[model samples]
Target: MSGPAPLPAPYALDDVDQALVHALQIAPRADWTRIGSVLGLDAVTVARRWNRLTEAGAAWISCHPAPVLAAAGQGLLAFVEVDCANGSLLDVARALAALPHVTAVEHVSGDGDLLVTVLAPDLVALTHWVTRGLGSMPGISATRTHLASTVYTEGSRWRLRALDRGQIARLADGEPARGEVPVFPLTDLDHDLIAVLSVDGRATYRALAESSGASPDTVRRRLGRLFAAGMLQTRCEVARPLSEWPVAVVYWGRVAAGALESVSRLVTGVREVRLCAGVTGRHNLLVVAWVKSLADAQRFEVRLNERAPGLEITDRAVVLWLMKVSGHLLDERGYRIGAVPFDVRAAARTAPTER
Candidate 1:
């Protein structure tokens, strides 16, 4: 039996590109001057390289820390397995791509036809979605879901890596960071501090100090140093169930590299589309749409097919279960520092109800 195929990628990257990614993972806000200083280049050169990466669609800059906002019962981690009908491989993939919680989707070469990850607020909501919503679709032979127990990693790090020295060239006047980038060893103090922060992002320095066996002053200084060195960031995860929406659907499709922007625009144009991003393996451009019920999932699919022709479709694997999710990924020390406030602002201006 044939299995799912690799999804389309907007561009290809080289080793230097890989290195650039590594460096950025370490410091998203690192200025061109600092980057150029280390790489023996100038600010203009740093900008050009970054532009190249973005233009190629090999990378994107985003602040994705919503996972931290999710409280225990507020969200679910799900894995979906999909079965297709009548050589409709591409069609099925396109349909699933449209789902809102289907953050990661892949057309695979394996026992199952397709795999997907979904997020919702509760089990009752998820049950209604699969049984009445997605299950009603034609050609969907079967769907299974696995709910996540704990998340090992989340946010930008899951998809992006830090840029390394090889990938960067310093600006003509830029200076390198003092000393070899110090890799802070995970000390007992570090671990103790992390333990406290993991429980409460806003915990006071005094409390952290008392728990970590460090003086209050020392704790403050260490945290400051960590923040400056780009070893930490603060973020929260937020999650709501699919049933809360009036409509939900998985819109999926495969397009030529040239048509990515058009499809992305079309996909995001719809109000229901919640999350959309490319993945490392196949089944790129995974999307999730939120709506009231299954009927909405169908209507969106029809419109999507008409909007983008020639794009292949795959299976729409209804989410059944989620295995593990680590609400957030702290540094090796498991602590985050210097992160901006959770910006629910992007969607706020347009969709007042969404957060």
Candidate 2:
């Protein structure tokens, strides 16, 4: 097989780019006018800049079923470690990166060749994919799956911490108020709505109606219900290599079950943490972070130790390369090249047949 393409030079982001990114992280679908007002820029200017960034693949927004939704039987989430045969790590990583259920894939410096995050509709679907689908792939030697018991924080919560509280308050004032809404079981129409929004979180209601074959009124009503139920969440993600913080770090740590809640809350409060969770495994807690450099990761660990006394960081890994993140497959330069919509319906169709 041919060798992989040469690594692209790192793309640099400017100060305005960073500010806009932080703003979007706070409100992924906020109107440009509101964002501009808070940032002291013209609405059109803000829109133009965002268009440029997205067109360059430097940033994007994605929609997914919230963790609460997953917990309510919408899906299953797990972290997987894959060991590959000698000299075949890249090939295996590339293959797994292309699979729809595999949301995030990274080549790391550690015991495993790759660390992957997967989402599936149910236990049977997860089992079939892990054993038959992934197991059948060539070049992979072994796999260890750790189911996430509680997702305290995910990429959606990670922010640049660049915007001040007042600025954030001003931006929030422009958005509509969200009140507590009753939870309901997801319908087939809801699934289709999620599939459409997963690709474009800011899709218009008319466009959503067209795609899902639902009336505009029905589409708007269902979407509000989903939001009220906390079943859907939108996130703004950037090309990490092009952002102000370029380095990615993952830590597997052990904490007492009693303290998991407090510890996770503390860790998630840290500005650098991108993902934090309580998982099932030797190490019950996992923390993922983004930093300006490798040294920053070391410094963050020291702070973590100080803040969460008695927590043991069992192992840490630096992400050397990210092949996929939240279903968006990135190129060498970290620009989005393709997307695999998070559609749980596929699980039913792909399930292994019983003998």
Candidate 3:
């Protein structure tokens, strides 16, 4: 089994740092000069703040589609808990951490286990990750998996924009003045597709063909490849909040020794718990769920306590506000496939001479 876990220590930042983070979250691509002008700071100051913020990892600036759009068929989110054998928790975590689909990894208290978040194209890929990728890791004794159904928040885009009627109208009219800073690598074709898709996921192939300057067949082939690769997915219109069931909660807990699978079966079988995992910390298990109201949240919690008496429920989070959520944000460091070769012929589409 894995040994002791490598818990990430909390890092602190001051007010200026916080402001810089907020600005980047709102507009990742804002020019230093423009940001400085808006914030009443000089360009140099803005640049310095940007550098410091990035260096500290307090925030990241990248571009990709929102979560809902990304998870259409190609991707899914899940939380995983691992109980290590020896005290080699970090070794196991490091191994699992390097897997292609793993995103966020944390070592929690209480149970002192490892918690991880992964994104995969489909259930088959997810299953392979759990059984082959993680289960094969040395020192790892146990694991629990939870599939994420709906995301309340992630990245920098929100499900519901906080705008007035006028602003909403402006947004709907394709005139949102605000810009987002995407940090993911983007190709000219990818950029063109994203630009169009942002306005309407259901836009016709001909329309996309026009905007992207590609033949209908080419566009179709590229989109097909992207979808197959788990990159450009999600074609549905934005969904309205589940008004009938608006409760969003994450529950973290752990099971008794030698009862991992039995408890995992019981927890995963619960319909109320949309996502459940065996995590590391005071609560070695984590579950995310959405219900109709606050009453539903409480009732689920009480039921969990009753069913898993030894399962320690440590911490819980009631999502109050989600500032941003998106799946299409591009990582600016490189293109989705690789470094897109520079082509002057395609410069117009890449930089867009007009805007």
Candidate 4:
């Protein structure tokens, strides 16, 4: 008989690497020169280090539809709790991960064996996915879903605190627009550009143009328009086990309608809070965090109660295994092994939501 698959060795990040990743989190596509200035390293060194990390699949950059995309009346985002049959966890996870619309798949302990995020064009699509899509799939015995109503913060904005305030300021993303702004419709061209960036958000304009069948100038203008329109947001990502924050936790909580915004904002302010969104479930507020240890996870829970008394955390799930994040598939040690590119044009076949 064949032996069991070999376990992946964890890749540790030193201070410089952590700093570089943190800088990219601040400015996803910041030029090497600016990042170098912020990190006190030469531009070439910064670029070289990034290349090494990405080449090894230790880190990467990807783009996804911004909150404005949903606010503009696009797809619906829902959290799915999947109960897998015995011995079928791996099969079920791999099958779901291969789907286009299923964005994230995590095997956890608590209410369910897996937490799957799904993004569909409408209720019809979501229902079909839950019924036929998942019901018919082998190994999945049952599923529960929670609709996301307001996404106050996601993992894209989560960053490591390796840099000082001044250095962080030097690499921060552009100031977000104030108040409710007008929404813009996304074009086929915009979708094409997004598909390319979903694979490599830092892809050069020339490369994007070549792959997207547009002129370099056109690509640049369209990307700027997408950003200005709040239709697209990109972020740098790394293998969790490789970074300082390796443990992942999800908190299902509730917040009063009037206090939702305020409480969410307060909770998100916590450095460990990677995602805090309003949902239409028993527990309305869903928060996800990345911490350094299991103890830290417990500590975070205590800190959360102190920080946002209005928010009542119902259940918390520690990700025992994360099969996929955004579009990247991960190994046992959380290193990237592959990617299921983000493509909304494949709506008929699309998968889950952002982090």
Candidate 5:
């Protein structure tokens, strides 16, 4: 057999590239013409840049079932710390990265060799996955799982902050309002629609209709309702090497249950925090941030300590490599070579109360 695929060369983005990425993060599916107007570039030029980024695996757009959908008893989310036999870490990480439900897998420096974030249709499925599915895998010596009780912020919310107010306003002008609406249970069609989006967040109504077998009008109406109900979220992700902030760090902290909400809100407001959640474990709060370099980690910690005096950071780990993120598996070069679309509807069918 041939050796593994060659890693893509390291790419450093310039100011224009960074600005374009920031625009996509703010409005992931905006038309190229509109983005061009805001950035004062031709629509063709904007689209060409995006094409280059995606082709290089420097950036991509993906859709995820909103955390509110899980919190509403439709699915289960958990963070699992895994210990592997000395020589099996890479093997184990690659295996986990291939699973549809395991959104992120990072080789870290901490109590475990790998940290895995898992999503399932419900608690029963989650429990089964942890106890049976993961337990049966080779090389995994031990595992400690923490169920995410509340997701105050997800990576999707983090923006590069490279665009100015006028540019941001221009991009947001016709964006759909993403707010909480009455909970209308997702239908089979909705599940199919989400599956389509999981691969291409910017897929048009006509494209979605073709894939999901719904009329364009039905797709449009359903998508609007889902967005309004806070059951769907879109994110623009770029390769770390292509981003201004390349270093990623994870923080495990302890905060009293009573202070968890306030502390979460505080941390989420920090521009560095890409994910902030309350998990069930000794360290109740988990924070993930992307920064410019190693030194920025210390600075961020200091700021975090000052902002939330009561929060105690027990452990911090720098991510050496990200094998997978969301449903896309990455090569060492950070190019998306394969995908296992997230299927939350499968989990929703097995709804078991959180333990």
Candidate 6:
């Protein structure tokens, strides 16, 4: 008998996988044919690799309302810090993860036991969600909520930087044209498309048509219009454990008057800065990042101090557990399993109805 087959090689994010993810990050819905061309590989090979990635839950493509909506007061975004009763952190994290409005749940190092990022349609909905929605939960806790005034950069902007300039340029082929942010409302069809894309941003026009009951051509035009209007954004995400940067941290910062906008712009340039926004809180700025280790988290602060002296880190939280990201529930090991579609017009799409 043939010797027992040698064990399969260890799974890892090899250079090729990184390149593929990098390409997708630049052009989230780029076809395999185009991405394959950029990577100098066969389209079939690229498609096979992508299938493996998604099947293993090592990566996924998801969509959410563009941050512009939050900034323009057309949608709501807030970060909530929660202090759970003794020994309820993990349970609370899982419970919070199931809430669609709670787009992200992170157990971090701070006085607070958990940090949750919430999305809603307006202030009233957000208040109700935070007060009645969360307050009614079993875990006993006090909560502090900070609303984002400006989103300089967020998860969708973070990239692996695994590909060179030329590769990225080729991958970004036929990028959609962007115009002034539309100061208007999205139609019911837009919401339908968004709900579908939230689960799979890479869905083909035909698939979107079938799911949303719009013709492929209509889906294309509406998607273009929504994009141009800055109503939605799509992103490719790799599971954290498979990434070079595994350690996550949240930084609460304060900046000098008249410097919030400029300083935020500068800080967001750091590749590790997954999120940098101006918020209404004692610490007016919020930054979230992923690094290689706890030591690297400190190094990030050092680099920040050197690069932007005006930004003061008032508080720091080393993420102990990241239960969810971008509406996708993750296992303890940080692999995507299922998604909670973010509804653009409602408080939350998947939340249970309150009595």
lDDT of 5 at 137: 79
Residue pairs of candidate 4 with colliding backbone atoms: 100-350, 100-351, 101-350, 101-351, 101-352, 102-351, 102-352, 103-352
- How are the candidates ranked when ordered by TM-score, highest leading? 6, 5, 2, 4, 3, 1
Residue-level lDDT tens digits of model 3 in 1-355: 2212211233344455554444443434445675565555798997786554433322334333435433445356666666888878766655554343454455544353766666665666667656666655678788877665544333233222222354334323431232132223336786577556543343567888998899998877665555434343232111113123345566776677577556666666555565555544455566666566778888988887777666667677664422112221112111111111112122111211111
Residue 95 of model 2, lDDT score: 73
Separately for all candidates shown, the number of backbone clashes (residues 3 or more apart, or on different chains) is 78, 0, 57, 8, 2, 0
Q: Flag the better candidate by TM-score, 2 or 5.
A: 5
| Model 2 lowest lDDT segment of ten | 1-10
TM-score of each: 0.42, 0.90, 0.47, 0.90, 0.92, 0.92
**Model 5: per-residue Cα lDDT over 51-112, one tens digit each:** 88776667788888888877788878899999999898888887787666678898888778
Cα TM-score of candidate 2: 0.90
The root-mean-square deviation over C-alpha atoms between each candidate and the true structure, in angstroms, is 17.9, 3.3, 14.9, 4.1, 3.7, 4.4
Local distance difference test scores for all models: 0.47, 0.81, 0.49, 0.81, 0.83, 0.82
Which tens-of-lDDT digit does each residue in 229-299 have in candidate 1?
43444332211121134233444445566776666666655555655543323454555555555676676
TM-score of 3: 0.47
Give model 1's TM-score versus the native structure: 0.42
Order the candidate numbers by lDDT, best to worst.
5, 6, 2, 4, 3, 1
Q: What RMSD does model 6 have? A: 4.4
Clashes of 5: 2
Error of 6 at 290 (Å): 1.2
